[model samples]
Target: MIGFLWETFKIKCLGGLREEVAREVRRHLRTNSAIRNVPQPFGYRMLKRFYGKGGLLSFLLRYAGLYAIIMLGCAAIVSLFPNWVPKSGLNSDRLPDVQNVTSYFLAAQAVMIGLLFPVALGVISLITQREDASSTVSDLQVYYSESFAFGVGASGIALSIVLAIHVFWPAGYVLEYLGFSDAGTYFEVVLLIAHLLWLLVNFAALWYFLVTSLSFMRPAQRALMRRRYAALTAIPDYLTVHLLNHRYIVRLAAEIAKKVGWDKAKTALLFGGRLERGEVELNNKALSGQVLSNVWQKPLMWVIRRWLKRCNKVEGAVGSQPDLDFCPDFRRPLSDDGIICRRIGGIPLDKIERFVVGQSFRFKAKKP
Candidate 1:
């Protein structure tokens, strides 16, 4: 009885899931004018483009909330510090002493550096994740190695220029007129400026590295093909179902779906959507699939990809000639008319391949 009940529950769950998926697919088909015209994911963009829409206002609010929580915790820890480190009785920096002024300046600089370290680390980590797929301890080493090299090089160049102005030209002479009489004071100002410049250089380097690195993630030849295919393919039925299940995103998706046509809007939605789950099929039979899997995984991924490639080639030569031209690019025709074309250029390639090769062909025509 218990087993029967469990089985019944499982059946109901799957049925409900399928029904939900179908409803979303049908809804997009009906309401999204551009759906049929555009590719997947972008058509789904109806769901997840809020960050683009809201811009700085939403970003500020998001970061502000994070800052508030961090500051609150910082306040608690700061409160505890006074109890741990008691006030000194010594008059090292006595009242009204010049030494006190210097000490205060040092304390302020120390505090600033303390605050800046974590901020720098966080920025570096976030930028690295956006730009680099390397996630191991070695990733950190590489990040720091590059970062240090860049920082030192930048600082050296900047210091050299500033030194030329101060030493070779006698810009240091002009500083005397500006009431920075002491050479030490002038040097300190230059040092501070150099520090600020170095910080800016670090940020610039990070941004540059991030953009360039992520761009290389895709193979040069495949990027355009993948994009074209993606546009043609459109989002799968499942993603639309997943997005509409989220209340806020559903409203956003509906609005975008109105203008971009259902397909483009859906494509956009999926691009922006926060994916809760994902799965990848590793099929070396598809060269592109094998390449992608190898790029994403370990030696095992490479081995599986190579094996699949060999099998695909063998299977392809054995298949009937009719099946050879299956999955021909019929996007232009498919877009121009709602009709799904099976034959390529009036040739019954699929049937010919099957009949001649006398083997099971896995490739199907790119149509329903």
Candidate 2:
């Protein structure tokens, strides 16, 4: 029993870690895809189809919330350390009474972590929406516009501060190693300038990374995180798209298309022509051939097809032959009714789940 429990615990832990890794992978993929599409001018115009203009106040409130939550989290963690926050400020050098103050602070931290963590996560999730929604445009516009510029400016300022701090409060060992004994004026200035430039470049890289991270967040959430942390604000939208596309939706779409048919537009329209122009001509020729090749097939197919042709029903045929398998994929058209068409023909019942069925293959409703 103990061994069994141990094995079960290990499996659960592994599952949790796997989820975390998958999440990270998805984030990175979304970022990369966003970056690749950045240079395409017309794409931005196309993105407008996704959403309307975003409001400023709602956006501000989101970030403000994020800032408050993070600060609260920090406060919680710090509260645990008695030395950091004493029960009283009079004895700065001495640690706070561990027994007296620790329990209260720890309890407060626990409550804050429990309450704020979920709220922060929800706000953060909005900041970086994974779903294809209207909000994407507003989020994207901010990252490419003011947020990105702010990152660059902030990075520059940070770099300058790092340089000043490093140079003015120079460590004696580092200065002496560089052969600057407070005598070599010109050489020291050159070294300082070089070091400053290096620092500036590093800061810029850091800024880019941060701004990109913000891409995953909603504009309001990003704003709040930025207000609180003063970190990067840019995010790679492509990465999110890419991750989601591959890991979930698009992959499923592709699999369904491959199983049923490649002509997405034609399938979507529930029409005869293929999606691509060349394929349309080819499909037309094939239809003509299908009519001629088996004169009895269409009539037989038509008779069998009529069973499920009612206002709300499914219809199809079953055959071992390859071509007749096409009709099996079809079903009665969908309308105002809440029903979805379902049928299985040449394929086994177990395998039918993989194929899309309905009026339009793309508008799949259920497992059938």
Candidate 3:
């Protein structure tokens, strides 16, 4: 019965999750546009990596596994030196400190969910209304951000259960039920330390959430976001059939994706990389749009791009094809619509590669 219930619950979280992520991506695009705000996880970006990756157990394993270690380390120290906590003044009935802290802790946890739930829903509703897959980069950001926010809310609920127990039930009784010969000094130290740690983590999450929320208002962030939004919305039109399947551009994209933060597998999945064969396939064009995101969108040398495209069609009739004639430029397309990324990545690594690096790697690396 327990197993059956667990399976049902897991499905609710995992089922159609990718589609939901897609919907969120669309929603966040609209929300950001209406407010001219940049949509990103910012402080919560770490959670973005696992957005649509798994179910509840995975979240607990990742999130709990991360936070639990701190509490466990504290517990281990208390266990190792049980005598460190003097039993003389210890109260066996309850830890009075817990009563004082539980209310605030529960409130903080509540705030985490409060902030996350609405953001997730807003993203969902906004995207649902517009339903545009054009702004793939912004959409992807919104999707992952929504998934991360909602996932945190799920875990916060579980933590709130513990917080609530402390509020309504005696901590000593709860500890006794948790297991032990008695509610002793060692447990007290571990419990108090754990409480403090949870408090700190909750506040930290709140800080990040608040910072992200306020980013919508900051003039600088909004201007930057406006520019990026212009870039993102233009990406899809450039992603027409030929560009979607371009091998070299795809490779350059995959390389940049690797340098940014995507694992080899994800990069392969996105750009369909095969370095040995020197071949590339664009598996997920939308994701590829994300790969090429944040570049300065502009039309650069459209006359040259069109002439090049036409010239390339008959290049075999020529004596030899120069790199300039064979290779394409992104500035024209992404800027004015010759292509979505007509060499916007800066001149160093073709066009999109440098943009991917600065956008994904440096931007995220600098994020606090």
Candidate 4:
């Protein structure tokens, strides 16, 4: 009796789960716009075109051009007069203290470098096919955002306390009590601390800007953005699911149904009575015997099986031809689309052959 109850409960749970999955699938199909008509961003379109046909040399040239532009802008800014620098600390007519100016420059550079470094690392890692780099880059964004906010808040509070002490109490007397021999040393220490605080503030402000901008996006838009980011940054493990064919998706659904302990007939219904190869054949004796013992259930099951067979015939007819024309320009040796063509157009054939041979030799050598 206990075993029978457990089996019944399991069957109900599986049925409920299948219903939920079918509902989500129907919802997605209804809401998603026609694929060809979906508007894409200019930047994404440009990237797709570039990666489609651009070689390694083109990639290097593109980044080099960007680097040159950034360097030129930095040089132009640094050539300005010293007086242009903000006078937050002290008003001195003489050329601002070299140490203080240099410290400020270093702090500013550190903030910019810290923000850009992770993005560059992620791009390079994607090109080199490193999954670990993608994970690191994702974590870096979260870490920097949180750390910057906390550091700036703590530094601001500390600075406020110190200023209050200097304004109300005798700061010089306090310094003397602490055994500071010279005013220059004390001022230099204060200058260093100020630069550190400035750096933290800059980082936190930029991070807040990023967060604020992203917060404006709707939940669905944000999810789509993250999915695209993940696809671009990591090797495509499930690329076939996005291709023009529905057979692969159907087969995947069938496998999932089997894993969840669905019997053959229920699995067939889930997949519209069709496997990847052909229609599933039902055992008449089993269906009429123990499986459909109730007289009412027998008729309902017969209708369901007939409906599944019709759906399978429709699906088979629709999938008889290739769904989309294969574009030559978008081929990559490691991608599913490229596998069908067996060629990488932009890259040199000799280089491709040499890389394949080298990989094969290495594999053979690794085998005992």
Identify the leading candidate in terms of lDDT.
3
In candidate 3, which residue ranges exceed 4 Å CA deviation? 1-82, 88-94, 127-133, 136-143, 166-183, 210-368
Which rank order by TM-score, best down to worst?
3, 2, 1, 4
lDDT of 4: 0.35
* Model 1 TM-score, 2 decimals: 0.20
**What is the per-residue lDDT of model 2 for residues 1-368, given as tens digits with 9 covering 90 to 100?**
44346434533432222233345754554566543443333532332221112233432343345434533443453446434432322222222232223333334334433442344345346646667675565554444443233333333343334333433333323334543323222223334444444344434433443544545455565665333222112332343334433433223334434544433432221222122211111111112212110011222222223322221132232222111112211122233322222222222222222222221222223223
lDDT of 3 by residue, 248-364 (tens): 345434443343332343113222221222221112222222223122111112222333344346635123322221112222111121122222111113334333322221101
Cα deviation of 103, candidate 4, in Å? 21
Ranking by lDDT: 3, 4, 1, 2
Q: Point out the higher-scoring one by lDDT: 2 or 4.
A: 4
Candidate lDDT (C-alpha), each: 0.34, 0.33, 0.42, 0.35
Model 4 spans > 4 angstroms off: 1-155, 166-171, 183-189, 192-207, 210-221, 224-368
Can you write out model 4's per-residue Cα lDDT over 1-368, one digit (the tens) per residue? 44346444533433322223334444554464553234455744533443333334543444345434433333343345324433322222322353445445464645565554464455335434645555555544433332233333333333333333333224333334544312323343444454455455445544543452344134464445445444433213223223212332344344443443324432332321211232212212211111110111122233333433443456452233211111111111112211111211121123343233222111011112
Give candidate 3's whole-model lDDT. Answer: 0.42
**Quick one: RMSD of model 3?**
17.5
Those runs of model 2 whose alpha carbons end farther than 4 Å from true positions after fitting are: 1-147, 166-169, 173-193, 196-368
Distance from true position, residue 108, model 2, in Å?
46
